[model samples]
Target: MPSSAPVAAYPTSTRPVSIPGRKPRTQGLRNMELAFLVFAYVIVLAALLQVQLGVMGEFDFQLITVFGFLVALTVAMHLVLRFRAPQADPFLLPIATAINGLGISMIYRLDLVNPDITDGSVPNATAQMVFTGLGIGVGIAVLIALRNHRILQRYTYIFGAVSLVLLVLPLVPGLGVSEANARVWISVGPFNFQPGEIAKITLAIFFAGYLVTARESLSVVSRKFLGLRLPRMRDLGPILIVWAFCMGVLVFQRDLGTSLLYFGLFLVMIFVATGRLSWVLIGLALFVAGGTVAALNMEYVRKRIEGWINPFDPDFYEASGGSYQLVQGLFGMSNGGLVGTGLGQGRPDITPLAESDFIISALGEELGLAGLFAILAMYFILVSRALRIGHLGGDDFGRLLATGLGFVIGLQVFIVVGGVTRVIPLTGLTTPFLAAGGSSLVANWIIIALLLRLSDTIPNQATTRLEVTT
Candidate 1:
């Protein structure tokens, strides 16, 4: 593509010549941001130590592994941004680091309670920190090499096909692992991963690229109904295909949460591309119909619905399909009250999967309602920053990609939180930074990378002030 092509994929800072007038410049505040990041690390490390001290009643030097992991992760990322992306967003890296560090702390606390595992491997806390480092490594790689977000657009079809394959891999014989009634994991030797987590990123790129090329055709409407434009029947083919795929995931993979996420992401991107309410209405109708049919025919879906609808019923509560986990999370949070019971003081380990799916409840029990609000506020800030980047993107492709990525984080959090609070049926999904899943951490960190790259493209004043007098 040409430097001045329709998308302007080249960096503005690289242009040797500019309009001759002087312009004000705003520095990227990179050093200030790095300082704040270090401060946040201090708090997180202290919190983790507090947990250890409370439980062990003594200072322990064995916490060096966690310290080394954080130092390596932060140093690697900090060096990358300083050399390669000095002008990127300041808050995102810090926010992610804090959330991820706190998650490890919570997991370590649970590890203390458990103390022993089936095969007697390393501690869950150490394993989680290792994954955290791996996640950071992916982000740094993306930042160093893929300086522009638009490059991914060139291979949209390839990414789309790969995403589809990843979604189906867990269904293959010997690879798929069925746990807690969801066959969404693939076991490779000793390692287990959810391909759907990686699929979210690839599929977002697919949706963005597909919509950008097809928006002109999909945007036009021949008929108006009640002052709203309804998408043409011919234009609806793409969404129908995606919707059907999501239904397939629901049926074959038995992962209702991932299916809902895929469908919701596509729906949002289509609406943003076409500015049509009719598409959303149609998309929602399809999901509801598909979900209803699945609920009737699929025993797992039926059980999920029954559990959501009647959690307290005598037979249902005690049955294998019961909402015991949900109810227990609620109780744990309630026990937390206004302020938390303090770290290591409460028993969040009592809940099933407290380190992954129900990490929020674990935090709630230890950190209290007030602490949860603070944590949520941090998430709100992170999402808002990503959306702000999307809003300022110069081209449709960048705009849509940023929007889709931001919504990926927001929607996942809402789904996990809503499920815990009983606002929606429980779907077994990992919490973003707060969960103990490596796939989720890696995927989310890559998202952070993309957002940083996207933000870098929107020229700050400093980027445009390089014009010389000639």
Candidate 2:
């Protein structure tokens, strides 16, 4: 009886609980994010300092102001995420900041050596700095206000309308500004804006919301053709409309890059949402056919194609629309060799439009093949993380939206970088973040903002399971 009474008082275990399928989202990793920003700032500042010393024989004191401005802007956005988007991915902002900072430095370097700049005219670097601040401001506003990405779905058609308007704005009589044979820009007083840049973001939102609603019909109501599941004629309506829209952009807007980019984004998103390869095949067919037909008729298109085919040909160099820039860029990169010519030491300014269209070449000339690879690796990493978030996203709209946005970045990089490297035709597309353009910067930063917000909404499986058990 005494032994039984003594055995009745056992203690319970107090070990840490491990939920079977839970991965809690308790840690924000804000410190880690800030550390990356600091590292990126150091690299940017060091590069700029080298450029000043290498070319100007001393440090540009203005860079100190630029550095302070960028750091403050980044910190402001960081605080927004810390409070508003606590679960957002930590690396996106830092990566973007690094690319952007490097771009600004490169532009400044090019500006310092630009013999083309008139005595009283503003340097592109100063303008780029202003744009960077504006872009960061826009991004911060988006992050602080947008608590949920799905709210975009509510204005799906509205986004479509807005995108349409923006696209057409460049085609308007007085507003449209034709530069370098691409009429995808609008002039507002002294400032020229590429409305198509913003259009891409709005169109992605529209495509995501639209496809999610139509996925059922587009996926199941299809026929097998030549061992592939091809959507029925009625089900093919959306893709067909998209193809026509792409062609319209190419023809009217005169932007082969933007047209190809939009179509590619839609085609990939459709396939992802429906698990159908037919859409891709069909889209490629449409693009090739449309592009070939346009090339045969359009003077600009023909020149671009010919240039890509033989950039080094003297005919290409001496033509009305010569590939002198392309040839010059190739020579610059070739001169860079393995490591680099050391930032300010190279003749990056010799290439036409070196700050924007040929910025990759400018970067390649100074950083060399190894550095170019590192920069591309950063872009690939960002795209991979975005895809990861999308694949893990539970909601169809969020998944599609995230995936589409990621593709926009990936495909655009391919188009622009490929053009620079002679892997594809010159398409007048600016490199994201690294190229000098305010509209591109603003649009891209907004995309980063949306992606961060979406990541915040994605729940951790461990947290979900733990909460359920509790």
Candidate 3:
């Protein structure tokens, strides 16, 4: 037998195992980071209050209670989010909480100005507080239970069908509420439900599921003409049909904003997934044509266009006129030019639906231009983060879901802020997270939950895919 070669002893040194290409996951507490940010926000708000109320001598207990409650609820949400979704982006939840808190504060301030406007109510901050609690609870439940975004893909058609049913449900007899120039709400007992809010999320999921499977085919099956790549006419049939159907919904429901939102969101996701610009151009042309037609035919649409063009028209002040709300919104915003007239000082009562569509105007009036910019910056950051997460996600479904959700938020914010500022025709769309509607609140919270799920999967997604393949 040949003698075994002497084994060579290799020296070993202890060091953390580092993946060659991938970065190590950070262990910072995302929830704690969010809590600290929120705490800082409260401090800024308190400082503002100190300057306004302490200096001007207009402080009230109601304002203090509202701010205090918002801070408390934010802390509670942070606690719930800590254990539920530890890997979620630290900024999303805190930004959402800040927006919600600001909305409640604005609403409470408005209530103090004209008590009768709130229907003889003291303040509905408590109701919003309750809803925030419920929304956060639902968010945690979704994060804990769903486990993955792909699970939602299994029910894509079901969600779509249900969402469609809910969207059309308001058209049923004795169910819909025709308010704010649209019949989009369903009355269920004392609480009213906006089915469109739910519809947006469900349709988004369906869009993501469908697009992921078809992206490659759509990209390759294109006709090249004039040095531009366009999807084949046959391949475009489904998207066109969906667009027409959405247009029909807009025409019938008198909801141009949602129609624009859904159509734009669809086009964006498709373009991003397929890297196609032709679809975007086609969608824009269609939107422009549809907008012109609507402006010509619909009185409400025409009035909105005119209002945007000339909000300061004398005729707008007539009791039953188009510019009444817009003019009032302008006044409120102008009143809060720089640092705001203080939270409870500005006349937010001038604007109708100040707590919903025109909440930004109220914020501008009370919090000033600085506050308005801060709010917009928050939205920009949120959208940017969502997009970053989409790019980082390993799977097509996660990427599309996050992209679609981000598109929804960005588009909604643009539409609403533009409407309030009279930069575009007004449409009754609520601001995400900041608007005072239960459906909107719940929908946004669910969005946050989905993002958390996507973020959590990002680190291990590659290994999971490899394991499955092996």
Candidate 4:
């Protein structure tokens, strides 16, 4: 004999329930990231081995041992992301690591030929290794501390103020240091830092945050001008102010590259924010007008323009601040042809600034066009993923921030690579992670961390929606 409670009958039909703003756990994202990291490390180790065999005619076990520590740090970063940001983009870290490793190998090759590089200062390769480690550490810290990407919006004006101070720091007496005709670095004790590198990051945050609230006003349409809807005269203050700021950077700091990068970044973000083609057109006209004026009035600007026009001119080639470096880089790349001169076999050392401004050329000389294309492809993938993250984001601020950061890297690459290849006049901007500068390394790595954070937080519609069975 059994006493039974009435059985609760389940519904036969099932329906999907909508849950807005609900986040679901992502699967296998960390595993994919780990796989890519391992592949990146393998590439780094192979490149280092080839560099050693080519430069030293033998392997150096001591250097490899030291590099193991850097690898360990990267592994630690991967583990941190596994725990903190499991949904982050997988390609960012591995791509950066591979490029950084190649840079280290190239720098090491340069170090082998230049014995005087270590006189009273750290060797370029060693310093770069240290910077890479520090950059990775900074990235890890960013991921650990910054739990949400939206938190940055709170400090938009503060970031703006900080960027302005950074831009102006190079003008301060005793603390300011001028190098390579640009007054954009500050000297503190024995270290010289380029604040503008970090300023770009801050400025991006400011632009994104400012635009989030101001896009509607800035997007107001007036009369049609040249078949495009233009903004009202009253609403033009922001663009004008930004244009003026860029001109100031050009005139005072003599840094045309930084000015262009900052302006282009703002222009891209504003266009994305407002969905206005007229703003881009207006921004372009303003920049062109400004560049034309600077070229007419500034001797250095004129020289750079003239150099870009005719680098092979005998007089310009032999001039003090002319196209010698440009021509040498071209010649070296020509010597490299389709497939590079093979690591240490080429005389890339003959080119000045090979380790810094012209690292792309140095890479072209050794790795050939194929290798350069491959590296560029990696950059493309990295930037495209960032833009994708922006596209997938549910919030306006996160979308704008991701887009701004992506443009920062893309524009900087175009500026550097274009200048090197004579597509544009050269300006003093580092090649992101590949160039030998601690400030740039740290700033770019922090950018990677921000992108990772944003990726993790982007709402996945597929993952969030669930079915209920009755």
Candidate 5:
């Protein structure tokens, strides 16, 4: 009996296993990365200032302060990202920092040319810098907190509604400040906000979400016409409505850049999601027709066309009432030639809004063709990265979102660069990260963050599947 009892005892069960959450020790490394970023920024800023002081004989301490503050803000953003979304793509925050730093440097350079903000005072580069910091802060906060694009997709409609409200708000009596060209900038205290920038992001989300939901139906071939496959006639209505609405916005708001951006984005998304070349052809035909009609009916559009054809022809310039801005831009770019006059040594002051629409010209004057191509390369990298993210994304919405965003970057760069070079009619669109606008900078940072989040999710999804299989 004693021997049987000794043999029958079972091993005691082990205590339940506990897995620890991955602590963000990488936060220290992130801080080091941010420190390197700030260091690079300081080097660039110092180089710029040295050049300016050598040529112009003076430097502004206010501008230095602004740079310092912006650097501080960027460091803060990195810390926030480490604390919140430690496992997120590390490249994103540094890329954002570089972009923002570049923008600030450009703005500071412009401030040198137009230092008088209010009757002999140094222009408030500090203010722009502050906004840049704020934009970076908001971008990091959104990316860290949102954590997933699904949540954004879930509320796409609501975001669209809010964006639409913001877009139309300028139409209200007192809120919108209408310039001579018909852009409605709302001035709040000292800050001017362009709702169109915000609208672009919201509309892209809505378009991506809507397209993902409707992809299969839209892809269905109802018939063919002239060797071109066509979608069901019912399916065409939604796209048509979107196109018409965009046209209305163009006609009413005089926002040619926004209108073109929206239409192009929609067409590209439709083509990509459906993988149909026929849709692209149909969209192209519709675009041609609409453009022709716009040119004929809209005085402003007609002017743009005439300006594009021959900016220097006196008769065309007079009839189209082409302003001095584009002319100055051409002059600045031409003065630079192949190598440029060198930073701080060129006459970029002649170009109106040299910090915004014509910043490329300024960059050309200062940094030469090499610098211009470098900026273009950055845009190309950004677009390629977004497309890669789209391709690797696990879900239709994420793919569409990434693609739509890539399309946006492509279109904006084309429009702005073409406008500056006089290859197309001047559309007053900022050159994304390099332009001096609060709304544009902020909106673009958010775009970068979303793309990074999407990039992060792709790997995580793949890893999860592999783990499940194992």
Candidate 6:
């Protein structure tokens, strides 16, 4: 069914012409992604097999079947991206998959130690697998439904309102469910969801859209302080409002992690939009003052600081609401040493909330410092790619959004990992893709979809410019 025709293009005028035989570079990029995904999945499968062998002393087909289903879902997502977002960043999905896979395997390993687990009570690993599929499905839905990230800019305030509502929903008396000293959850039938997780994304969107329009005013220099150009006092309204809101969350909601995350996200995005270092300094000062006051006044907050400062103290270690969990997590990581005890060899489950809040320590106890480094390296690559997307983006909104997204992930990793390593006071922030919270997983996958969409537009925007010139 071949027609005899010229494969080459000839330009008769000053306009550039497309060749009939030419292929878009996006196809090549997608091919590279496919190859990378293959390698990533192979590593995941190998890890799962090692866990099975180490824990059960025999290969179990159940986890393998779950892994197969996960692979199918991810492959389906990859295919969708091929047609929908071929020019998207290739590394995001693979890195997310590898981290999520490791989390699932570790959770499964921990489940093996639970002899009391019954068929009626679904294991954490199985629940995590189901949630992973749901997250991917939501991601695909986002890609299909949200064709352009710019459309979100149209409803900036609407998103801001939604974020506020979501943030306060956990504080509603009848609906709120407090756990682990923080009121950050709400029960929906059989599940407890953290609305703040989704709120983080919405807040990022709001910050990006608002900053794109307000950056000019925000950039107005009032005076110099400490050799830094500061914004006008009037411009300080925005940061002050956000800072107060964050402090309110800390005081009322009793959730330090979410409060810090929201403030940090806004500060980073605003600073990026205005190219202002003074904003960073001022924001840091405001948060430090707020935290200090809270630490001095609040009992729970004071105890957390004390726990971080001296977890081994006999008085604090043996108290009812003491440093027992933190100390145990440290001991577990100490057991890991240079290299891990291997996947299933270490007693990671001995640490409280090993598969959730203290996942990094659990992973460290089994995978060692080297394995942790490898994981952190993947996180570094992922965050760097997001920042690169922001830098290369053609539009202001895209740039700010991408930057905010990168900071959200980067700051979260820093907080969680720093807390685990005793470098900072611990807070309840899930490790993006590697934690066992369905709300966090769904929100993060949606973030990936947004990043993919933004990256896809970079090439399309370039082609549009070229076409306009031609």
Candidate 2 stretches greater than 4 Å from native:
1-28, 178-180, 461-470
Cα misplacement distance, residue 195 of candidate 3 (Å)? 1.0
After superposition of all CA atoms, the RMSD between model 6 and the true structure is: 4.7
Cα error, candidate 5, residue 90 (Å): 3.8
Candidate 2's C-alpha lDDT?
A: 0.88
Tens digit per residue, CA lDDT, model 3, 237-309: 7678778867877888888898988898899898988898888887888878888898899887887788778
> Model 4, 98-155: lDDT tens per residue?
8888898898889888868756778888899888888889999999999988899999
Q: Name the lDDT of candidate 5.
A: 0.75
Instruction: Give one digit per residue, the lDDT tens place, for model 1 in 326-382.
Output: 778889999998899999899898888899889999999989999899888889999
TM-score of each: 0.92, 0.93, 0.87, 0.94, 0.86, 0.94
**Residue pairs in candidate 1 whose N, alpha carbon or C atoms collide under 3 angstroms:** none
TM-score quality measure for candidate 1: 0.92
406-453, model 5: which lDDT tens digit per residue?
789889999999999988888788888777777888888788778867
How well does candidate 2 match the true structure, expressed as C-alpha RMSD? 3.7
Alpha-carbon shift of residue 13 in model 6 (angstroms) = 3.1
Winner on lDDT (2 vs 4)? 4
lDDT of 2 at 301: 93
Off by over 4 Å in 1: 1-28, 178-180, 461-470
Candidate 2 lDDT at 61 equals 84
**True lDDT of residue 378, candidate 2:** 94
lDDT of 2 by residue, 8-72 (tens): 34454344465655444434366678899999999889988998998999876877998899999
The per-prediction CA RMSD against the true structure, in angstroms, equals 6.7, 3.7, 5.0, 4.0, 5.4, 4.7
Model 4 gets an lDDT of: 0.89
Off by over 4 Å in 3: 1-26, 31-77, 117-122, 460-470
Instruction: Give the residue spans of candidate 5 off by over 4 A.
Output: 1-43, 58-64, 115-124, 318-323, 460-470
- Model 1 / residue 126 / CA error / Å: 1.2
